[model samples]
Target: MTATSSPLFRPLQLGPLNLPSRIVMAPMTRARSSQPGDVPNALMAQYYAQRASAGLIVTEASQVSRQGQGYSFTPGIYSDAQVEGWRRVTEAVHAEGGRIVLQLWHVGRMSHASFHADGLPVAPSAIAPQAQVWVAGDDGVGRMVDSPVPRALSVPDIAAVVGDFRRAAANAMRAGFDGVEIHGANGYLIDQFLRTTSNQRTDAYTGATLEGRTRFALEVAAAVASEAGAERTGMRLAPFITQRGMDCPEIIPTILHLARQLDATGLAYLHLVEADWADAPQIPESFRAALRQAYQGRLIVAGGYDATRASQVLSDGFADLVAFGRPFIANPDLPRRLAHGLPLAAFDPKALFGGAAQGYSDYAPYEAVAEATA
Candidate 1:
């Protein structure tokens, strides 16, 4: 497919599965699940089924355990009830002939005790942070004041968390997703372990040597891939982000090396989150080349991408697939809208995070417009 010409309608192979198109719906938290740690609801299922026309759908970052949650009314993939809830979602999506992958997540230090079911949050370092998690109480919604001091993860704790991810993958399969995406980006647990600023511990995990610091993620990739099969597992990373003090001058090489280690894992794809935050460093082309070489499997790039820009990227040959986030929120049938150049309904920026179903699932689709015109 050429850059100037639109080839998005053509089918492509993402790992072992064939995608009808290259467009993917990147996971975004809607915070509308039935409860803080409840299973997904029929409303959530309807939301995904409505957008099933995309080549593939990567669900919102769902915590592997209650302790991993960072917000209220988000879903989990650990418990039996949660698994059953997701089964409903997967059934709906599959009925429409769409493939979906559940994004596995652990918030790490980006959480508060109020949000934590276990009452303490794990971080790479013990240094208190200056951020608060959004929360709600009896009266109404509000951000929790006075952030919880984080507890540095012990070596044993690190092993336990890995087990949690394994369990989550198992649950996801039971729920009948096409695959799972490991959330290693956007200041989450994996990102925290990858950065030196957050991981000040003297353990092998916070390896003083470059290779040591990359060990945790490497092990995680192998573990999840071992259980889920390489084709059924993918990873997401933001190498340039430093929100909770994630620093690494050798960031590019570090991530590439991590991908190299996972080369044997036979994973489906690697999704890179490249946000255009002014303070955040931009990824050089060299890094993309190295990533292309390291990951012999499918590659996906996301964050702040539009059709023209994403089309250029596809032509550049660095990424085989691209995922869209906020666009999917406004246009449930985003691929159709992109193909036909339909006007997009504006998303209520305020209602995006946590809200009722008004903004979440009320957006109309192209067929509705057709019926209206008829």
Candidate 2:
């Protein structure tokens, strides 16, 4: 079958945004932001613009505040400079006729003392994930370091974090983003609160019940939606991955509950990040059916999806869009390559983060590669 006939090539409506195709560029942490302030730069803008052929582009996770930062050189959305820096990125993608959204993030327990002023990361509870975060040395080289136990957030502190999300959503709009995506996946702050094993709080925020465990995530969704307009708001969730010691069975039910609530909020879409690794567990069909029944919004699934699998899911009516992660990273013209069955370029693991244009914007388009070979 030709690319034109594939379901993945069909156009879809995400709230007010009209996507040209079902292929989305998933949000990834490149850690290539300008140093000293964790601000977005022209090089990052160029990188995103080069991949503008995607139907939708979710920007790399940006810290909601300095306190929310975990890795080195990851851009932030809280500061004035950060907002202005992101403006360049949005403008670049917009000029290329691509829609872009800013992903608001707060890394809870997955952080180190160097990234914090109080020398302590914060979470729903004072538990350590034994996770590692990338921190930069004085020489500007990045390295993975062990995460420390985080301080449990107090009632007031929880409210403050919600406020930070609201402010960050507003900042994204000021920075020229078409919308905002709440980063609730990948064992981040919201994910920590959602999983029962990580949140042992007795307060209303983590009130112990399934509803209580999900309160923080729902509150964040509501706050971000209110700030960005529900139609322009989207969120990402990972229900399968057991990272950061968060392998609780109750998480699936918690996600289903959030799904129902999010559907009612009239949000643009819900992004699900599947466990793509070879050894990772596959998402059950029962759970997928349950999610489809619970949520009525646009659904996007990502995780090692090649052309055939993407088409199968879309044709089966299981998902409205398909997001490609590493494929999009290595091939800037990923949509074209997938459509035409062109050979893909491999990504350099070493140049994945905190680097210049060597492995980033320098990835040649298929035509360039063809020309060089010819």
Candidate 3:
């Protein structure tokens, strides 16, 4: 592609954020945060700051509360110390001329009994997710174990979760994030409430109605947006196949409903995670078209997108921005790589989880190698 025609290089405006290009660095969980989940260290800051060239950056899913944690060594935004630590990270990114948005999240029943402080894992329903969780137990490190069913939430408890999101948003701003993304995707708490099989409650949050399942998400958006400002707020939704559910008929209407409500909020963007590596069916393409119109703000499409596909989708106007996750992990200069059409480095999947700094900060940028050779 020529310079004038490069979709990766063209500047784009996402809500009030004027991005230098359409390339976005998707949020990825590397489980490399400080131990006991206190804060993100200098190494973490360097990691993000190095990749600041992307048009926009979405930090990994951060636990809004201790109960929101689902994995080991991930960061949190609920505590003062955590916020301070993230402030350093944001400073580093901004110093490098990059903007970042924090992804606020709660793992819900996705957590294990051992991870919770009070030894209690929260969930929308008492039913076990039938999924596996990676825990850190004795004998060095813990492995993937079957996920136990979570306790059903009462009406009052639902209200409390909404408050958690609000406080998390406040903390994100204190930490210097340009924006905040409510984690409504994946098979987490928000997704559990939205899906039918997980949320079988007869309460107002349940039933087959769109208002019932989507009410919780709307509440989160409304609460978080109040703090982050509609132009600085966004959401990530994996309506297709996620650790949540793939083939549900309910996902369509729920997403459509969210787009309609979110459009009115004047949020910056709605990140759609559509993964093709899964074994189940995909989200109907028609929904994307509907969402394209349903949401008036910027739309970011993430997951399994290459340079060619991203450009084509952007040209087709299906998405305003395209986020690359795994590629970003292995290539800090991914935007330049796509622009110059260079081959990408392969990532070590095993090292992607918990690690010191090997896979985390050791990835070399394109310029470093070029300078060395020259």
Candidate 4:
């Protein structure tokens, strides 16, 4: 199908914002925030502004607090400087008529001890993810290091973290974000709390019952929605992701139950992060149908989607929007390129993280590239 007639180019009403297209720019951590304070900067602003053609842009995950950090150079939403820094990004995107939302994050046990003051990451339980996080040394060299056993969060600590999420939502609004997305996916803090394999606690947020296992995630959603307004708040979930020792047989049901609650609360949308790597498990069609039935709000599906697959999914009524990750990194005008069936550019792997502007904002739009080639 041609660009103008494609379903992917259709307009969407996402919450209070009227999106011009159904293409979304999924959140991907580039880890290029200003050092020392882990704050967003002008370079990041330039990077996001370049991709303004997306119907919606979910900014890279920003930790709600210091304890929520997992990798070096990831920005945070807990400080004044960070809020101001994000304002520049929102302003730049707005100038180009792009809509953007901030993704609030807490990495849980997917972290190195170097990020914590007490040398311990906190999770729903003390279990280790058996994964590695990228930590940079004093000399600015980064390497993957094993994640250590985390200290389980206390009841009080859970309340504190929920409060942090609330504050982060308020901070996001102050920073001029069009909305906020709670990062409940990818085996992060909320994901850790939802799965029995990671959350073995016997407390109210235990992994035994579906209600208990979903408590933390629900609380965070309610709190953030309250602060950011339910119409402007969204949450990302990874129901089928099994990496980082997060394989749980009950995760699918747990997510569906949580979706019902979010639906009742009038959440703006639920973003599902499907497995994208080679030979990754395919998300079942039954699950998608069930999710669509359970939640009445808009749904966005991301991972390994090209124009054909994206349009098919939308035609099947499984998802209202499709988010592209790596494609947006290399093609600033990703929506236009996809709509026009233009060839995509490959992103530089070396400069994917902790870099200045070489691979971050140096990518040219198709018009510029065509001009250069000519």
Best-fitting candidate, scored by TM-score: 4
TM-score (C-alpha, index-matched) for candidate 2: 0.99
Please give the clash total of every predicted structure, in order.
2, 0, 1, 0
For residues 1-374, could you state the per-residue lDDT of candidate 1 as single tens digits? 33225656668987667899889999998887876456799999999998999999999999998889887778999888899999999999999999999999988888877766667789877765556666666655855554577888988988889999898988898899889999999877888777776677787876465677788887777777766777899999888765555656666677888888777667778899896665655668888888988989888888778787777787788888889988888788889888777777678888876667788888888778668879
Compose the digit string of candidate 2's lDDT tens values, residues 1-374. 67889998888889889999999999999999887799999999999999999999998999998889999999999989999999999999999999999999999998999988889999999999878999988888888899998999998999999999999999999999999999999989999999888899988867378789888888999999888999999899999979778888898989999999889888888999999988999788899889999999989999999999999988888899999888988899999999999999999988988889998889989999889999
lDDT of 2 at 33: 87
Worst 10 residues of 4 by lDDT: 349-358
Clashing pairs for model 2 are none
Per-model TM-score on C-alpha atoms: 0.93, 0.99, 0.95, 0.99
Against the hidden true structure, what lDDT does model 3 obtain? 0.85
Whose TM-score is higher: candidate 1's or candidate 2's?
2
Clashes of 3: 1
Candidate 3: regions farther than 4 A off: 139-142, 242-247, 278-283, 370-374
User: How are the candidates ranked when ordered by lDDT, highest leading?
Assistant: 4, 2, 3, 1
- Model 3 residue 362 CA deviation (Å) reads 0.7
Clashes of 2: 0
- In model 3, what are the clashing residue pairs, if there are any? 128-149
Error of 3 at 71 (Å): 0.6
Q: Model 4: how far is 279 from its true place, Å?
A: 0.7
